[model samples]
Target: MQPPDLLFLGFFAFCAGLIDSVVGGGGLIQIPALFNALPNALPATIFGTNKIAAISGTLSAAWSYVRRVKLPWALIIPAMLAAFVMSFTGAAIVSLIPKSIMQPVVFVLLIVMAIYTFHKKEFGLLHTHLVVGRREKLLGVLSGGAIGLYDGVFGPGTGSFLIFLFIRLFSFDFLHASAASKLVNVATNAAALLYFVPTGHVLWQIALIMAVCNIMGSLTGTRLALKHGAGFVRVLFLVLLIGLIGKMGWGMLR
Candidate 1:
């Protein structure tokens, strides 16, 4: 790629990291940007290269959140493990499934999520006490597995879904939910990379430059979330859901 193309993609990578760190729909930005910039590249190569940048930003955000937020380790640990395994499985089977099948389903789900969150004004505002038990752990694992599978197969809003699930299932506020989602995302992205890397799909030069830009953006976003707290994240979450809805709905229509 030329310098101009690298700069163009770097700009998008930074934006993706910023939005993704706060809410989890960064792929909605990064993936399309990849496809647009590298129009001649194989789809798998684009996805693999994107993962390199994504995982870098996600890891930075996850570490930042770990320092600032009080996460539920009991829930997150199982979820992370489950996400890793299931994401790997999803990546392996990705080619077997068609993207058309998943687009409308995600579109409808995003709509419902947006509507419910909009009506519930106090939703994701305050963290509830988590009671860790077998049932709760099972729920965590299942959620991780399901979302991870989706991420590996056709990831656009993995972070948004993870945050919503954390808030809805575990009664976590947006801030904590965002923080927790980062760790699970790290696992899922890493799992995808395991497949992509071995298959020689990554474009390392582009990915490395994008990773630097993404890390910078992720750190900036993490600082903002830690400063502003849950109410800020709640608003951004709703906004991201709308964006994801639009993206998915448009894809379905196309």
Candidate 2:
């Protein structure tokens, strides 16, 4: 890749990490940037390379949040385990699924998420702890599996979906929900890597550079989210949702 391409991707990786640290749609920015920069590359190679950077940023953000915030591990661990297993399953079968089919589905989901979040002003403001039981654990496992599968297959708005599910289903505030999402996301990323790395699809040179930038961005975003609180995260989440909607909608149209 040329110097300009490196710079362009680095910039987008940083932006992706920043957004991802807060809400979880970093792929919406990073994936397209990868496709644009390496137009001739295999899609698997691009997705593999993306996981390298994404895992780095997500791990960084997860650590940052772990230090500053207390996460509900009881719920998170099960979700992470489910995400890891199902993510691998999804990656294994990704080739069978067509991108065209996933695009419209995700586009519509983004619109609904945006509308719901916008309509409910107090959606993620207050954190309510769910009494851990069969139902709560079941919900967590199911959501994690479904979203993990999606992340493994398409993977633009995985983080956003995780956060929203945490907030809506588990009664977590935006801050806590974001923190929880990072753990599940890490599992999904790792699971995908298990498939990608063994298949020799990753571009380490480009991925490392993007990873550094992504980590820096993730740290910055984590600090801001921790300092600003749930309201800020909620607003950022909505912004990212809108962006995801527009990006996917435009791609479908063209």
TM of each candidate vs. truth: 0.97, 0.96
Against the reference, the lDDT scores of all candidates come to 0.93, 0.92
lDDT string for model 2 (75-178, tens) is 78989999999899988888899998898888888899999999999999999867888888888899999998998787888899999999889889999999
Against the hidden true structure, what lDDT does model 2 obtain?
0.92
RMSD of 2: 1.3
Q: Enumerate clash totals for all models, in the order shown.
A: 0, 0
lDDT of 2 at 173: 97
lDDT of 1 by residue, 1-254 (tens): 88999999999999999999999888878888999998899998999999999999999999999998888899999999999999999988988989878887888888999999999999999999898999999999999999999988888888989999999999999999999999999999999998889999999999999999999999999999999999999999999998878766776677
Misplaced by over 4 Å in model 1 are none
- Candidate 2: Cα lDDT at 198: 90
Question: Against the true structure, what is every candidate's RMSD?
Answer: 1.0, 1.3
Error of 2 at 226 (Å): 0.4
Worst 10 residues of 1 by lDDT: 245-254
Clashing pairs in 1: none
